[model samples]
Target: MKPEAKNETQEMHRVEMTIGTILRWGVIVAAAIMIVGLLFYLVDGSLGVASNYHVQNFHQLLQGLIAGKPYAIMMVGIFALILTPVLRVVVSIYSFYREHDRLYVIITSLVLLILLTSFVLGIEFQL
Candidate 1:
């Protein structure tokens, strides 16, 4: 292949590697956070305390998180787990844009839009 082609291929590979790293680390970190929360619950024996699931808004969620609530921490980990793939979609959009692959950029952008819309609906409808 031409030098330019080789360089482009290398760049794409690097981008793929970055996406893989993001997913791997996202899951690992989220899992670790969840495990810590679980251990805290086990040691503290706070299962009787009701989980604050009706987190009316982001501010409430942050307040719960700041208060060191186990369920809130676990939910944050789960949210991170759920968002990892959406992050991949975002990175994919950037990679495609870098490659000047307009079609894929548009496709990935649409995927991101759908993901955001669903998240919004989930928060609004308490799904």
Candidate 2:
């Protein structure tokens, strides 16, 4: 094996190690975001109902929420639902940047756009 070939192998190994570290940390960040958000709900007080107007109930909020995946706690669930995806995004972006992956960045962005469009569109269709 040529000296230059050995050098290349070492470089590849280093790159792989870096990528693995980034991925592991990314998963950790996402999980932490979810867990922290959930804890907030458990420790916080409940959202007080201003007044229960039997004649004028806002089922829209309930319908929109129920149509989607049920959250564990209303506040924490909402935060966790939003935060986890966002944390994943931060992780993906961070990993892509660390790996210097232009193509992956483009693909991630496209997928996010599609997912967001679908989520928004879903709400509209629910009504």
Candidate 3:
């Protein structure tokens, strides 16, 4: 292979590895947060009553988090989990842009746009 092509291949490999690492760490961190929250709930003996609990919005989530609410912590973990793939899409867009792959960059950007749009509409409609 030409040296230029080989270097480009290696760069792509590195980007893939970075993306993999991001996904791995994102899941691991989210799971850890959720586990900690679960443990707190178990210790507090609030598991039974948790069903009726609701966090109305981000502001409430923040307040609950500040007050050390286990459910709020769990919600944050859930948010992180949901965002992992969105992050991957964002990274893919950047990677494609770096490689001058306009088609892929556009495709990935559209995927990201769809993801964000769905998230917004889901929240707006409370779905």
TM-score of each: 0.91, 0.40, 0.93
- Give the true-structure RMSD of model 2: 8.7
Residue-wise lDDT of candidate 1 within 94-126, one digit each (tens)?
Answer: 999999999999999999999999989988898
Q: Per-residue error at 93 for model 1, in Å?
A: 0.3
* Tens-digit per-residue lDDT, 4-122, candidate 3: 99999999999999899999999998999999889988887773236767766789889888877888889999999999988999989999999999999999999999999998888
Error of 2 at 121 (Å): 12
Candidate 2 lDDT, 24-117, residue by residue in tens: 6656665665565455445654323333312122354455344431232243344444545555665575566656789988888777777778
Candidate 1, 42: how far from true, in Å? 0.9
Best of the two (1, 3) by lDDT? 3
**Model 3 weakest 10-residue run by lDDT:** 47-56
In model 1, the runs with Cα more than 4 Å from the true position are 51-53
Candidate number with greatest lDDT: 3
Model 1, C-alpha of 36: deviation from truth (Å): 1.3
For every candidate structure, what is the RMSD over all alpha carbons to the true structure, in angstroms? Answer: 1.8, 8.7, 1.7
Clash tally for model 3? 0
The alpha-carbon deviation from the true structure for residue 54 of candidate 2, after best TM-score superposition, in angstroms, is: 25
Strongest candidate by TM-score: 3
Query: Arrange candidates by lDDT, highest first: which order?
Result: 3, 1, 2
Candidate 2, residue 25: lDDT: 66
